[model samples]
Target: MATVIFTKNLERHLSCPSQQVSGTTVREALDNAFSDNDQLKSYVLDDQGRLRKHMLIAVDGSTISDRIHLSDSVNEQSEIYILQALSGG
Candidate 1:
């Protein structure tokens, strides 16, 4: 099972807890984690089911490429981090 972790900033606003879930893809792993708390899902994803503008997801410390479908692959030992990206200059 892959471990999904939400940043403290995100955790402060939403109750997204680190979870150990099983899945072959990032989307699957996220969905599995959401099974425990669906509210967390809505916070990270928009109505289009795409990652929200301020949100970033990474796998194994590398940035995830598929923001639209979240198709990034996940392994048993993978660490998935969901972060809130800072914007504005």
Candidate 2:
């Protein structure tokens, strides 16, 4: 099972915790992580289900390749990290 961890900043705003879940794709892995927190889903994904612009996902130290569908593969030992993207003017 892959492990999903929300960054400290995100975890402070939301209550999502690090979890080990089963999935083959990034979407599936995230789905398992969000299964208990629907509110977190809205923060991470938009109405169309694409990753929100303010957020980013990294799998095994690399940013996900498919933001539109989260089709990036996640193996059993993968470590997935969810983080809030910072913006500056």
Candidate 3:
């Protein structure tokens, strides 16, 4: 079971109260999170189910490079965080 922490922006759309989740891989964890909050799915991913350009995923504080194939192995103690990247000056 991996623990996933979402930013305040994401929490507002999620049905679950806690930010933690349990899954074997990144995709599974994200899927579970989205299941509880389908509204957020489109915001973080595109129509093709690929990570949007403005979204970023970090595992244990490290950014992931494989956005399309977000199948990283997760552990019971792993921490996953999804954030919407800010842009424009």
Summarize candidate 1's per-residue lDDT along 3-79 as a digit string, tens digits.
99999998888898798999999999988998867688899999888999999998998999999999999999999
Q: What clash pairs does model 2 have?
A: none
Better of 1 and 2 by lDDT: 2
> Can you rank all candidates by lDDT, best first?
2, 1, 3
What TM-score, over all chains together, does every model reach?
Answer: 0.95, 0.96, 0.80
Query: Residue 52 in model 2: shift from native, Å?
Result: 0.1
Residue 12's lDDT within candidate 2 is: 80
Candidate 3 overall lDDT versus native: 0.78
Once fitted onto the true fold, the runs of candidate 1 whose alpha carbons sit more than 4 angstroms away are none
lDDT for each residue of candidate 2 in 1-89, tens digit (9 for 90 to 100): 99999999997898988999999999999888888888999999998889999999999999998999999999999999999989999
In Å, residue 37's CA in model 2 sits off its true spot by 0.8
Cα lDDT tens digits, model 3, 4-83, are 77677866765434456778878888888787566788888788878899988888888877789787777788888888
Best by lDDT: 2
